[model samples]
Target: MGTRLQNKVAIITGSTSGIGRGCAELFAEEGAHVIVNDDGSRKGLGEEVVEHIKASGGSASFFRADVFQSEDLRKLIEYATETYGRLDILMNNAYKGHATSVLEQEEADWDMVFNSSVKAAFLGCKYALPAMIKAGAGSIINTASIHGLLGGLRHSAYASAKAAIVNLTRQMAVDYGKYGIRVNSICPGRIVTEGKIEFLKKYPEEVRRQQAVYPLRRPGTMREAASAALFLASEDASFVTGHALVVDGGLTAQLPDSVAEPLEEGLGLFRTE
Candidate 1:
């Protein structure tokens, strides 16, 4: 029953699933009118998410645009302004290119990764700023990752993109603070989503072993990350900007010091079910 974002107009890109979808749904639940922006290639999941929101008595609409296209990004902002008369939040979250390793990653793959990931954040802010300036205030949340601050075995491009986003968040906040626009980034650790779940299904043993090292002994849920976004987007975080809020179940904060151990009975990162 929290109306923290009552009447705000928000656009969340890559909202077909994962963190973006979580943000869109939670924003709606918090009384923000949401634009469910998707790249339109997912298997009807994006539109279905919009339907789920409306079905829950939350306000939402869908827009399909490839974030790599400048024109599409422009139209996305336009759609928000046209549909809602003002845009209060812009979430840059679409990305492609998950390579096995930096050495194995191709040049074209590197280009595509930055183009869709970091470039979208850069460009989305470039375009969304005007509308937000006109509205007098807005929030922009970018999806960073634990890899941004730390690193992973085979995520050079993704890690770099996220790292850049964290810095971009700071730059935007500093540049636009006078204009009442707040920009921040979220560096989520492992969040269990349909995509990750599918990946896990393909490598069950590795996933289980990977899950063991975390202090939480489990991955985060999408809703948990979305709730953090809700706080940043709402008035509750009015004084917060240019920060990367890590939602990693204390993994980054504590687990690195602990000996890598298999899940022991009663000793876990999550609450015992």
Candidate 2:
């Protein structure tokens, strides 16, 4: 195993599946003691992830907790410190949202999206900060999205929450730098998570059309996203903080004309899915 994160203790929220799962595995492979956190709904999957890490000769443990609950988040951080004796990293990667424009979205939808995406990050930071301060240094990685940098239809709550997270990363960085804690975020575009893979299988033509717009001409994988998190958590990024590293395969760097004209007819194809 790599020693990039050797002897570090990392708490990754919502790490049972998708990008969170990828981060858990990669952090373990890098010799970090991983605390894989997920909600009770995915207890079995969380256990499976822990087992997978162990089989690969990595250290990992699963903790079921709801990110939206302040008490749960507090306990999650406590669990990491009590079990590992130090908290070196915290990746607030949990998110949940549905596709709906502001005008069409219900109050309940807004609450759910904000609580899961924005408020949960807030709570994670709130509880993890003291432990990190005690450790003398720490890395905090928030998983924002390209949607946070750019607007999209039918993603009002999700986009707004992500945008808030990006700024929150910056604000936290400024506040915690004195304490040796680095705060940053990752803005991913079209990552190939398990759910996205399923969607692509059902819409092969749409995939080709979407790929045509990106400079890389394809979607990114969860491993790629995990690598970015790994970088931010490692000493390689010692000088980096309060930065939203865009891992979008150059999607955000392109001019609107490249995709806008074609997207006029294919706008429906571009979604948070």
Candidate 3:
């Protein structure tokens, strides 16, 4: 195993599957004792993740915490500290909400999005800060999206929440750098998570169109996004904080009209599935 994060304790929220799972597993491989978490919505998935890590000779355990619940968020931070005696990394990577325009969305949709995306990261920082402050160092990785930088149609709630997270990360970095705590965010564009892989399989044309816009000519992988989180969490980024790291495979670097050239026709027509 790599020693990039040797002896560190990492709490990754909503880590049962997708990019969260990728971060959890990769963190473990890098010698961090990972606290794999889920909101209990995935039932046995968290344990399954733990088993996989253990089989690979990495240290890991399962913890269930719904980021939407403040108490649950508090306890998650507590669990990591009580079990490991120190908190070195807090990866706020869970997001749940409706995918629609604000004009056509429900009030609860906005609430859920902000609560899951923005508020959860806030609470994670709230509860984890003390232990980090006590220990004199920590790293927090908030998973944002390219939508946070360039708003996407039909992703109003999710996009807005992500935008909030990006700024929140910046604000926290300014507030916490005095204690050696690094706050950074990763903004991935079209990461092909499990769900997206299925979608890509079904909508090959859409995949092609999405790739055509990206200089890399493909959607990113969960591992690619996880690597960004790993970099932020490790000493490799010791002097980096309050930065939104984009892992969008060169999609966001393009001009606005260039990006819209191929996607304009399909805007608001793509389904979440």
Assess candidate 3 and give its lDDT: 0.90
| Candidate 1 residue lDDT tens string, 102-178 | 77988888899899989988888899999888877999999999999988888888888889989999999999998
Clashing pairs in 3: none
- Estimate, for each residue in 120-147, the C-alpha lDDT of model 2 and write its tens digit: 9999999999988887899999999999
Regions of model 1 farther than 4 Å from truth: 261-273
CA-RMSD of model 2: 3.3
- lDDT for model 2 comes to 0.90
Ordered by TM-score, highest first, the candidates read 2, 3, 1
TM-score for candidate 1, please give it.
Answer: 0.92
Better of 1 and 3 by lDDT: 3
Quote each prediction's TM-score: 0.92, 0.94, 0.94
